[model samples]
Target: MSRGHRLALAILLLTAATAPVGTAPVTANAGDGALVTAVPNPTADGDAGEYAVVRVPTASTANWTLDDGERVVAVPTDRPAARVALTATPNATRRLTDVPVVAVPALALSNAGERLRLRRNGAAAAALTYRDAPEGDRLVRTDDGTAWRPLGYQPRDVHRYGPATVTGFVLPDSPSLPVETLRSARRRLLLAGYTLTSSRVVDALIAAHRRGVAVRVLVDAEPVGGRTARGAAALDRLAAAGVDVRALGGPRARFDYHHPKYAVVDDRALVLTENWKPAGVGGRSSRGWGVVVDSAPVAADLAALFRADAGWRDALPWRRFRRGKTFAPGASAEGSYPSRFEPTETTAAGVRVLTAPGNAESALVGVIDGADDRVDVIQPTVGRRDGPLLRATIRAAERGVRVRILVSGAWYVAEENAALVEWLNGLAERRDLPLTARVAEPAGRYEKIHAKGVVADGVVVVGSLNWNENAVSENREVALAVRSDALAAYFRETFVADWQGRGRVGRTTWVVVAGALAALVLAVVVARKTIRFA
Candidate 1:
């Protein structure tokens, strides 16, 4: 009851109020399971929109603080979670990702990069050090959370399938092949392409839809030449028939172009190096290559890819997309060629599905790098000379492998292709390598070359992947690597025929050439007579 006893009791109560909460107070150590998972730099308006993501092992981050060498901001305690995205502008950060964002008024990430430390109780818990941050990209922890890498989007995937029987066909010679494949679909059909204007294909798709088959189509909203009236009409017809139609492209599109040409029909997957237009699938023009694989796994993988692309935020419904759109008048392929190559059913030992913005570039390069006997490539146009695919082909030739590249001779690319051929030949002569490059001469067999195909040893690559950097690095491209000697032989035969300009000109072409020659001769005779008389 004394004054000294009262003072001692008050001091004891004060010490108890400020003491640690438990027998073992939480300690801040570098080995603690906290980590700085992701950091976005140079977003929108410089560093104003930049953000950092930190992950803690326990649910609450109440005691954590983030330090950027110059500024230290307390982690918001309003929302307790294992992962929290701290940013100066919470609204702006939320637009970039769905991760929970916490506004830390003092949070500012340096664009030039620096060390970021996560501290608790004034001690270091974890730290992340980075160099110059790339613009429009985020430095995020890998899947294993061991390292950091710059990425603009989620990591792409490479799908692989086991052995299956594949039916191979070339364009202009077998236009009916792809249509027939579509018609054969009974359960479901997921088609993806850059353009779709082939009347025969549309008819088949409509028929499939009418038969109660689930038919879905996904195309690019803004293709290179823009969406055409014919394409829009076809899409309109499909949409009217209760078919699900979508277009992939917008301000937030994940890919530069939805340029994959493929279809999952029931349990089969059809992959092509052509569009769904007449020139590509109708075989009216273009020397393209396609295949129908009767495999459940392949079809499932393609269907999954279709769903991923078509389900993205950028994929708008056809009706919704065409609301304020004006379509351009587009030309259709009308030329006909002799059916020199027929669709042949063959079995492949394995099929590896490669996608772009992820694995196509590296996988194709690996295929070429593994070639031992011969490597043949046919493309409309190639990327830069130093691109990965071209460099791989050159490397193949350097290692005593016979390499042949046939590029398109279409007027639009004839000059550039010729220059490339000349340069390739010059390099071959200088290095004494077994490499040869040539510009394809259609020779009346078909129109310009449009196939993006490659035959390497016993493997054949067929799909929408162009041997260009953008097509392989930025686009949502798909390609299949079929390992089969028989399939290789079929594609090899077509490649050789096109390369040698040995395609059999149709009877109509012969008649035109003959008529032109006869008229020229008659004109010559008349000119001679007139000159003598004068």
Candidate 2:
């Protein structure tokens, strides 16, 4: 059977739903933020046990109750239902008896479908309903109660249109502002990105920290560093406010730059193509795509990733930015081009994640290899001619597939992409391939195309992975490869608008003409030199 056929069968089997796996707990990051992590019971000699950890951020004299749909699991009799602190408790595992409760019903939770709810002063604070959970694993909220994900302990098969839903964002077109959505971070917030000078986003993190929320930020150290860099200044400001801010790539750094643009708020993960800078997400700046995913597994995986990067280790040593470091001002957007298109969204399934300093290139290559028809790509720029991804695109075109690449036409991007366009056209002609490439016109409101995405044969891959070797091999990156024609079509629509600007010569056609003129000039120079020698 075809891949699609097999995927459909798998989803069908999941819908049948056997006796639900061990009760999957629902934990929300907002409201009275709750955490349900699986830890080894010290009393049980390292065997696993579920700990219902709750955080009441406010000072309250009211009681809170934990219910598993049927009966009251545990109720705290003391004032201030749970720990209300800015930091996580030292040890998360607690026995049922440890809870300061008035009474406890059957302590052992049901393994089948159960609606776990948390109520504060008789008001619903947060709740999670789960079914068919894997054994020995714990479910936690990546955002509010709306999204839940299992901690990513091992690789999982892609679920076809699984329970996960993907919400997309195109800058300046999103219904609500990105910063507005970010302000909802209630429990713990983790942010990782290359550049972050946006006052709105930075202020949000600072405010969340002051409000006693656990907030941590990790950013690239080099380009965004120095006493003059705006990003550095922002980091310093956040650090001063008691927010744990670390710079990736110290002297003994593993990656060139920590370039993943994402934020994990509660149980939700916001993956974006734009940075947290003004020119990135500002309504009338660069054109890009952002994806909001509420999957417990994905959120847990990203959270684990953030911890690993933020923690001090021998291999990837991180340096925390100290206060008083003079930081440069933010970038100026004096000559930004107008955006031609607006933001749009589409749902997708079978989403495969790719992380860098890992096997991101291989995963992307695998997707490209699967394309049988057309492939459309949009990126800020392509760095190397012989990069694995670039070569793969060329090879795909050699196989008679129509391949078109669109890169930004902004001043910073135009130079690099010019050489790339010329190189791709040359290869296509020499190999007689059906490959074409273009640089987006800076005519519209969209000054640049910062999005790094691909649409190929009923699949859509979008996120912060740039079209460069450093991004693939040396920098931290996150990408989502989705298997859905609806998503693919949405991207293809943007690619077409960018590829066809007002009265412009095709990249391949113009490159051919430019090549001919250059060749003629070189031939004349050679003839003159030969005559002089004679």
Local distance difference test scores for all models:
0.79, 0.62
TM-score, candidate 2, is 0.61
**lDDT over C-alpha atoms for residue 23 of model 1:** 20
Give me the displacement of residue 11 in model 2, in angstroms. 46
Could you give candidate 1's per-residue lDDT for residues 1-534 as a string of tens digits? 221222223210001112332222122442353544455553466555578877655545447777867888887545656577888888877766667888888887765556677776666666665554554455533333322222335555677788899999998898888888899999999999988888788889899999999999999988987888999999999888888999988765667788999999999999999999888888888999998999999999889888878876679999999997888898887898899998899889999998876788889999999999999999998879999899999999989999999999898987788778878877887788999888888888989899989999999999888887678756889899999999999999999999889422223234556899789879989888543321
| Superposed model 1: Cα runs more than 4 Å off | 1-51, 59-62, 69-81, 84-115, 125-137, 140-152, 502-534
| Candidate with the greatest TM-score versus the true structure | 1
* Residue-level error in angstroms, candidate 2, position 308: 0.8
Residues 371-437, candidate 2, lDDT per residue (tens digit)?
Answer: 9999888888887777889888987897888999888877876677787777777777778888887
* Best lDDT among the predictions, by candidate number: 1
